[model samples]
Target: MAGILPKLIVFMAIFITLLTVIVDGESHSFSKTLPLRSKKLKREKMSHLHFYFHDIVSGRNPTAIKVAEAESTKTSPTEFGKMVIIDDPLTEKPEATSKLVGRAQGIYAMASQSELGLLMTLNYCFMEGKYNGSTLSILGRNTVMSEVREMPVVGGSGLVRFSRGYAHAKTQWFNHTTKDGVVEYNVYVIHY
Candidate 1:
């Protein structure tokens, strides 16, 4: 009976180990033992998308709105602490009446006290052609007065899955009094 008890304990331990492995197999499929290629995300490619972003803060139908600001924001040199939420239009051309391609929807804030630097977190959601319903996320810094500002394309969804790249933004035209701007965006991205 003593020998039988020891054998039964060993059997229980082996059974539990096998059960755990089977239950957790899907969650740990890409563990150290498995190679990344096993998942089969192959034939990566790069794409460049050019568009114009219109940020209108003046008119009654503004696209970008100042949603929040600190008490000292109005007096600050760079308006640091002012945050704006935007649903700006993305067009094929710099003109506001150009063909619409997508929308830049997100928030940006003045994050630098010494310079007019903004922390941008937005998504370029495409609505035309093969990119319809796809989105590319941008999260980086933008120095407003600079000749060219490069922002990172962190990730994406739909057609641009597992994407990473950068976007070059050049202010084509800006109205000082109205605080409206038209920015040209050239995005280069790598995706599978």
Candidate 2:
């Protein structure tokens, strides 16, 4: 009877531990958790599109006049470099406007590193502002490395979040020619 009681107690302890693990695992949450693969398609369909630009060589300027003009005027461009037009709407308030402009500049800086064939680095800038009459919170910035291949594509998605919204920017650069080593770049952004 004593031996049977000890074995039963061990079994009960293992069962309780397993139950505790299952409950705790289901409750963990991060502020910026990524969507599961099954949910990605649905989320992408509802997301607004934004454009990202990269300059892949030093001293070379953007060939597109429209892109240059938009940068000089501090207006966001729908299409630039290898990017295409998309329907991401900006928040109409002055505070939100400024924040987006600042973010654009930061993107430019990060892209410049890709020009030198280096991986870009993005840091968390918890700047304060307002968006849609609500307090704006800068979650964090994610830096994705560019790759050189036959058809260049951004390796991973870079993400930035606000209090009520978030943005994903992806970028890549490929060496198109060995002679003079011309590099081609493409960037994509999606907002939700």
**Leading candidate by lDDT:** 1
Q: TM-score, each model?
A: 0.82, 0.28
Error of 2 at 152 (Å): 12
Which 10 successive residues of model 1 have the least lDDT summed?
Answer: 27-36
Residue pairs whose backbone atoms clash in candidate 2:
none
Tens digits of per-residue lDDT for model 2 on 34-121?
A: 5555444334322232323332232344321122223433332321222211111232122212223112222222222223221222
lDDT (CA) per prediction: 0.96, 0.31
User: How many steric clashes between backbone atoms does each model show?
Assistant: 0, 0
Model 2, residue 61: distance off in Å is 19
